[model samples]
Target: MDTETVILGGGISGIAANYFLGKDKAAIIYEQRDSMGGLCDNFSIGAFKFDTGIHLSFTSFKEVREVFDMTPYYTYSPEPMNYYKGLWLKQPIQNNLFPLTPEEKVKAVKDYIYKPVQADDFENYKCWLYSKYGKYITEHFFLPYTEKYWCERAENMETSWIGNRLYLPEIDEVLYGAMSSATPNRYYAQEMRYPKEGGYKAFLKPMLSKVNINLNKRAVKLDSSHKLVEFEDGSKVYYENLISSLPLPALIKIMKDVPSAVKEASENLSATSLILISIGLNVPQDESKSIWFYIYDKDFLPARAYYPGLKSKSNIPSHQSSLQFEIYYSRSKPLSMRKEALAEHLIRVIEKLKLANRKDVLFVDIKNIPYANVIFDKKLYFNRNLVRQYLNNLGIQSIGRFGEWDYLWSDQSFMSGKKAAEKLLNM
Candidate 1:
């Protein structure tokens, strides 16, 4: 058998690469888990199906759209809200400031009209936000909350990742959003297409069908110089090219001999871990609204909440409802007092905030996923470019979220995988 290109981590990137590379390439994908899709997988208990994270499909690429067409799914009309500073601000907050108080609206409009200049060159995500939205708005919402979410101060992060992800509002639009009662542009509200049957895993199922996959096989060691990987089971595989979606730090550590500077660079790239708590509820969410909500209050353990059931019936058990709360923390942080204790705390917040109640909630499930995001710090670019150059010299290609050490949604992961496969095939 030929030892073709080796793809590590059976997430969207790996499968998409295989799809683009075609069968003649003899691709082999090795994943540590029992399944593919990585963060996009779904978990089920009884009749309720919960996603690993909020996996939504929206991209500008025609190829991405083509891949999305592989599944029969539901594209929702955007209806997102931000629960920040005790206010239920509409999504695209720049274009829908109705939730803000008169004073906040006035301040935001004034800031938008005459945006203040920042003194320093961008160093972190927070600094970038200040340059874009000014100090007050960043302080009131993006700053502290983003710090909580990423588990790092903004100054510790790089700002290049802000492209496309941060939507900048025009001055006229900001004023209109503040004055008008109508919602902002629904498209810019972060609307997305979701699977109706097996949840996000459904989208992955078909994409992965064409690829050769081996699950529960972790690549414990890598000899990228010779194009070889050693699995945990003592098995070995050789390849002409390797595409990795594993966390950059872990990937670097696995290499046969990494330089001191490369190792140090990898160390500087920190990431946020996530605890996804799911609540099955007896009461259905208000049918009049979409369930996406962002929270900034420290009291609310969740940085965000959403009702997947509201997106599609497949998300919930028969005759019941479901919602997900996203609590962001660092891996170094201790797990909450206990799972039950944490669940109760979240439930209490929901009740106190009038988002949900004990009677409405039937069950709670918690899932912890490390490396949810790549913290962009001051030396982020220097470290990232150094690592990239080193990897390139070794003829190793890192793709996708963790592999690239960048923040990217599933679409970007797919795009990265496709590009990497093309590069490998051409080589």
Candidate 2:
């Protein structure tokens, strides 16, 4: 098979690229999976349905809204919480310190009021955290939570990815939150939206109609020199222009005769793999009305968890609820226990946390996502740039979160594909 343009991976990025390229361009997308949507995809257990993880659309972009608004969705004010020492504090703990003990609150406020001067340059994420959040806040919350979520210490990670993701509050805001527990939601996203019926992938249904995708076409080898791709089923396709949304490392491995430096850089690129634990309940849950909460206690294996039932009523059966826990692991901090053992551990922890009871648990399911999020460690900039530059020179366009190797939401990923298609069309 041959085509003018070939897009590898039929995720939102690939779909968006082809959509923007127009049907007349005759771009073809090859996806390894039977279905599309990639990370935005969801799985079902009987009547219970859950997304790969927590996926909410809160984009302010007009282009993204125009596409996603095609589907029926429920808009909500984000009310995310954080768990610390058995106290439930609002999200952005720095801005909501009301749940802390009086002594702890005093120390946190004092540290913030007399925090160290901002440095000319931050050595690592740890340095940036201290310079911004002060000692007490960083040590008690941000530092520990960073290690749990990223599976790496803050000191070893880069600060480039922290753009407005973490809230930097005024001293008065912190003081007010410390005085009373009745504080408004301070999450970065003012409001979030989820599909009322279908899963998160439903938002892309409109775009999917405009693109051509071939499923179960896994590319095993690519001869960039000849502009040809060889799949596992012994099929070959020569392309004039290629756009790939494959993980950088996986893409590098399949390419024929890559430079040693580029190969080394690809090997150095690190990302977190997710073990998604989905639990269906026999009874309704109205206790924790919040969307999701971050787990700071090291005793809990999962970094965070969200209530899918809250996201949409159709996600569960009548009067039933469900929870999706996200446990992150990377090459450095590998999974300490097997998936089965980890699921059991998580169940027990959830029971102890009083989120659910063991008897009320209807069923438990596990899903492993290899490329959950890109790890922005100290070596990320140099290594990612090197590999991306090599691919660019080879006339390959890499888009989406994994392709670009950065933290991007759904809207950003969709826009990535559109931007790449535009670049190709202009050329």
Candidate 3:
């Protein structure tokens, strides 16, 4: 097969790139899976449905809004919480210290009031946390949660990816939150949106109509020197331009010949894999109104979890509720137990936490996603740039969260594709 342009990976990024490339341009998307949507896709356990992970859009990008508005969606206020020893603190734990004991609260406030002076440059994420948040808060909450979530020590990670993700409160704000449980939602997004009926994949339905995609076609080899791609199914495609949304390391491996340094750099780029445990309940849940919450306790197993049934009533059958837990692992933190054991542990912990009853569980479904989020460790900056530069020199444009190897939301991934398409048009 031959085309003017070929896009690898059928995720949001590839879809957006094809859409923006213009219908006049000849382009095709080759996806390894039998379906599209990539990470934004959802699964089903009987009538209960669950997204890959918590995928809510809070983007203000005009282009993204214009495209996403094609489908019906539900708008929700960001009501995320944090689970400590037993108390439920607000999403930004630093800003909601009222749940802590009186003595602990005093120590936290005092530490913040007399926190150390800011340094010229932070040694790592750990240093940044200690300097911004006081020693008490950092050691008690941030440090432990960071290790569990990232599967690595905060001292070994970089802070470049922490833009607006963590809230840094003023003295008065922290004091007020400590005095009372009532605090304004300080999450980065004022409102979050999700499809009203179908899972997140519905948002990209319109884009799917505009692009031509070939499912079950996995690209196994690339002859960049001759501008050709070879698929595992013995299909060959010759293209004038290639846009790749595959992981950098996987992309590097398939190329005909790569420099040793570039290959090593690709190998060094780190990412987290996810194990999603979806559960369906026979009855509705009224315990907590939070859409999602973080787990600081190591015994919980999952770093975070969300109520998929709450996102949309249509997600579950009548009088039923659901929960989806995200357990992340990487080369640094290997899974301590098998998938079945992990699922069992999650059920036991939730019951122990009194969030759910083991008897009410209707079914449990687990899915393994190889690429969840890119880890911004110390080696990420230099290594990622090196691999990206090499691909750029070969006239290959990489887009999307995995393609770009960065922490990108759904909207950001869409915009990445738009940018790649624009660049191709200009060229």
lDDT of each: 0.79, 0.90, 0.90
Write candidate 3's Cα lDDT for 62-83 as tens digits.
9999988888999999989888
lDDT of 1: 0.79
Instruction: Name the 10 consecutive residues with the lowest summed lDDT in model 1.
Output: 183-192
- What TM-score do all the candidates reach, one by one? 0.92, 0.98, 0.98
Pick out the ten consecutive residues of candidate 3 with the lowest summed lDDT.
280-289
Global Cα RMSD, each model: 2.4, 1.1, 1.1
lDDT of 1 by residue, 1-427 (tens): 2377888899888888888888768888899999788888888877888888777777777888887778898887767778776667777666678778899888877766666667656655666777788655777777777766777777666676666656787677777878886854544435578877888878777667688889989989988777789989898898987888898888988888899999999887777788899888887556765657777787777888888887778778667788888888775444566788889998887787677778888888988887687776667778888888899888888889888877888888899999998987787
Error of 1 at 74 (Å): 1.3
Residue 273 error for model 2, in Å? 0.7
Off by over 4 Å in 2: none
What TM-score does prediction 2 earn? 0.98
lDDT per residue (tens digit) for residues 1-427 in model 2: 7899999998889999999999657799999998888998888899998988899999998999999999999999998988887889898899798888899999999998888887647899988888888999999998888877898899899888888788888888999999987877778889899999888988998988888998999999999999999998888999999999999999999999999999999999999999889999888957457888899998888889998888988888888899989989899988868767877898897887888888888878887899988888999999999999999999999999999988988799999999999998888
